[model samples]
Target chain A: MIGCGWGLVYGVLNSLSNIMLLPSAPFISIRPQIALPMAVGILLNPPAGFVVGFIGNMIGDGISGFGIWKFWNWHLANGLMGFIPGLIRYFGIVKIGTVREFGILQMSVVLASGIAVAFAVLLDVCFLHHMTFPSSFPSWILPAFLTDAVNGFVLVPVILLAFRKILLTLEIRTICLVTILLLLAVFSTAVSITLSILDDLVSQEAVIENFYIAGIVSVFLLVVGFLASVVFVRRFTDPVIRMSRASQEVESGHYDLSLLDPVSSRNDELGRLSRVLQKMAKTVQERERSLRQQVQDLQIKIDRKRKDEEVREIVETDYFRELKKKAKAFRSS
Target chain B: MAKIIAIHSFRGGTGKSNTTANLACLLAREGYRVGMVDTDIQSPGIHVLFDLDTNDIPYALNDYLWGKCDIARAAYDVTKTLGADATGRLFLVPSSIRAGDIARVLHYGYDVTLLKEGYRQLIRQLPLDYLFIDTHPGINEETLMSIATTDVLLIILRPDQQDYQGTAVTVEVSRQLEVPEMYIVLNKVPVRVDREALAAKAVSAYDCPVVGVLPHDEDMLDLGSSGIFSLRYPDHIISREMRRIVQRLTP
Candidate 1:
């Protein structure tokens, strides 16, 4: 019952967002809000995610006068986007702590987007007469895949982090901050360019030409910016990875700090951390060595004392004295 | 039959001579006829423990080995040195302490077989219950000869790394030589080490019984090589440890 209620609300919101699309291809426009239902699905149970996504997309098509049954395959695809992320919770990956966990979450989001879009195109080929191969692929498939994947990848982690489901590590915090800034920069640039192209009093052909040129430039910038941010973020995080591995070696009683040499040589906070860790390992190793030596020495001391007391008791015995006297007397006779 | 017991070590300064002197004295005090031979001709030190003047020794083991005298002539009855209440006999076969005698022996190594024969002759002539051979550290011809003929071989070593490694080599060689009974005595151990653990480690490393772990007693160090530790300070920890080791070696 709660799933149905969420589905209705999500459907209405999705329809409203769909109406505000930026012009792109003839049949496919950029849809950024598609991640909302998917995020909600993953946050809740799989059933809730599936119902909300499927019902919402149907209601959206119905309200847009496209008829609910017209894009049934796309509705199912949207339902799957929510369903896949919900599976992450089943796998006990609701909380992201390490880099590996975060990578898995992001990869799943991208894969879900690709799979959903591909499913829709497959359905269209088998049943519907709308999408054709190669020509329709860039317009229908590429736009849907890129927009949904980018949105889900960016927004889901942000939502999870905000909900405190994902632990906020230094690496996560920096990446999130940088991503938000980069998104803002990209969105404002594209928005201003789009608004100017729309408001132009030039001919329709000129408007179309200007819009195409702006879209091409925006897409090119997005790809370049994403790649650049990845490389830039890696520089700050790589040392952390190296230091973590070095600490594991130290924990296992290996005092060799040569592996952390490169990290310690750097002139940054991470470098200082690496040096501190190396120092800690050295201190521990020294303590263990001294302790072992002390233990060995203590054993000898205790043994000496104990053994001496034992011999003293034997020598002082009356029996031993009597035996000595008898032996001396026997020798004399 | 007299038991020939050889006290050996792989490295010097492991208290082998001190231990040999003390063991001999302790046994003699217990009414057993003990004979101690300073087979370490190059640096004979057991004579000093008995307070025997090197110049007073008219016929030493070197003289016996050089065919100048009988082995019994080199044996000195030092039972009086035990100072009263020592019911048993103690005779010492002092090595020639003269620098030329030492140089001559080292330059032209003495007959290893003759030295073994001398030990037998000394034991039989003195009617000794036990004859202790104090050997030089490391594997030399005389040391090997002494080890091969001994009824018991006591390997002395400190708890130091160098001593431990050298001791292992000596132990392995003794085992290969098929010595009847072999025991390890960890000497000069610091008071801080765990005695039982060190004994266990030594036993496991060499596969030999550990007779004693003698700590670095201040009395022993202060006394130096002047006197027998067990006889001087009979109740001292080091002396007691020596007694225990002697008891094991004899039995």
Candidate 2:
């Protein structure tokens, strides 16, 4: 009963969100609601997610006046989109607590989207005879997969994080920050391309010629910028990784100075960090050496003192006095 | 005759208590009747490594030292703490960890003669093959007494300068006492340090044989002296080294 109610609510919401398309970019509509059922599935159970997604899509189609079975394969695709992420939880990935889990969640989302869309298209080809493979794939299947996957990937983490299911460590923070910036860049470039094509001032011929150039140039910039950021981030992250490894070595008493040389030589913040770490390690090593020397010296001093104390302890005794007298008397005899 | 071994270090945190506990457990595991006495009354921690509850201890080494109870009465059968079936029995004479007991022991200081007698009584009552004494760090009156009475003196030290100097003094003192067998067990040695070279250096420094050179082990650190490391990680390199040290000490 609860699952059916959730499905009904989600179906209505999906229909409402689908009706609201961006004016500037009609074809590339924002469908943030798709990730709702996916998050529900993951947090609850796979079947709950499947029921909500499948029933919701069917109800949504009925409400939108597109006969419930008009796009039945697509409804199944949506159901699978919710169901696959839920399996992550089912398979003992109950929380996205670490970098590895975070990676798995993202990859699973993308993979599930691809598989579901491919399944839907195959069903369409087989039963409905709607898709014509090569021609229709670019127009229909590609967009469906990209939109759902991207939406699910972007939104599921946000919801999970809000629910305190995913921990935000330094690594996750860095990745999220970079991803948001990249998404902003892509969103703005796409909006600009759409606006350029829609602008009335540009003649048809001019629009056709310059729009292609603008699109190509923006795409080239995006790729180059993405690569540049990745490299920049790597410079900082790589040293941190190495420094952490070196720190572990120090922890286990493997104070080999050579382990830190590569990082210490760099001329950046991480280089400074490496230098500081090396200094700390060196100080600790020196302190250990000095500590041993100090203890050894103390021991020598204590040994001398103990010998004196030992002699005093024996001489103070009556037995030692008797022995001394006996020795003197024996010598006299 | 039951062999009495006093494991001491000049400095604290040299894994003295940990090594003593591990050695005792391993000895017992090998089907030898082993008994351990925590002589570090000021800071009785070896009991924790054995997982002995303070509340359960009706009589402690302090009680025996104060003549409140017999040494055998103070000894607890700690074989169950090892979590294994031992053909040979294991007993522990833990010192009182109570704050008042610690302060009292430090302030009044028990008779070294009585403490030594208590150890002998404990061994006799338990019928132990070996009795291991975990001593307080540094040379004190009680520590010297324990050292004098023990058949073997195992001086534990880290690969550090402070330990080196302290151990030198201990070695010199023990030599004067004429301990039958004195061995050095270097603890928390770094991985990169050449074990052979360090052992050689230690041998020359004190004219004592280096019985074991244990590497700084993460598992040991993680265990945090809560339990015996050697018994817990029998196949670990540190445990292997510990077993080797035991072999040398036994013979």
Instruction: State TM-scores per candidate.
Output: 0.46, 0.47
lDDT (10s digit) by residue, model 1, range A225-300: 7777787679767887888788788878788888888878875457778899889888999889989877655332
In order, candidate lDDTs are 0.78, 0.79
lDDT of 2 by residue, A1-333 (tens): 666787898788877876765453333345677787788888888888778788888998789777899989878987898888888875578777666788788887888789888988889889998768787766677777787888988998999889877766555656776777677677757666766656764578877766676777677767876786787688667877888899999999877757668878864456677899888898999989876764443331224465456556644565444444443232222
Per-residue alpha-carbon lDDT of candidate 1 for residues B1-251, written as tens digits (9 for 90 to 100): 67888999988888888888888888888899999988989888888888898887799999989999999999999998888888999999999889999999989988876877787787778889999999988876677677767878999988876676666666665664567789999998877677888888777767789999998888888999887777778888888788888789666
For candidate 2, what is the TM-score? 0.47
C-alpha lDDT of residue A154 in model 2: 91
Candidate 1 segments exceeding 4 Å error: A1-290, A295-333
In order of the candidates, what TM-score does chain B achieve? 0.97, 0.97
Q: What is the lDDT of residue A229 in candidate 1?
A: 70
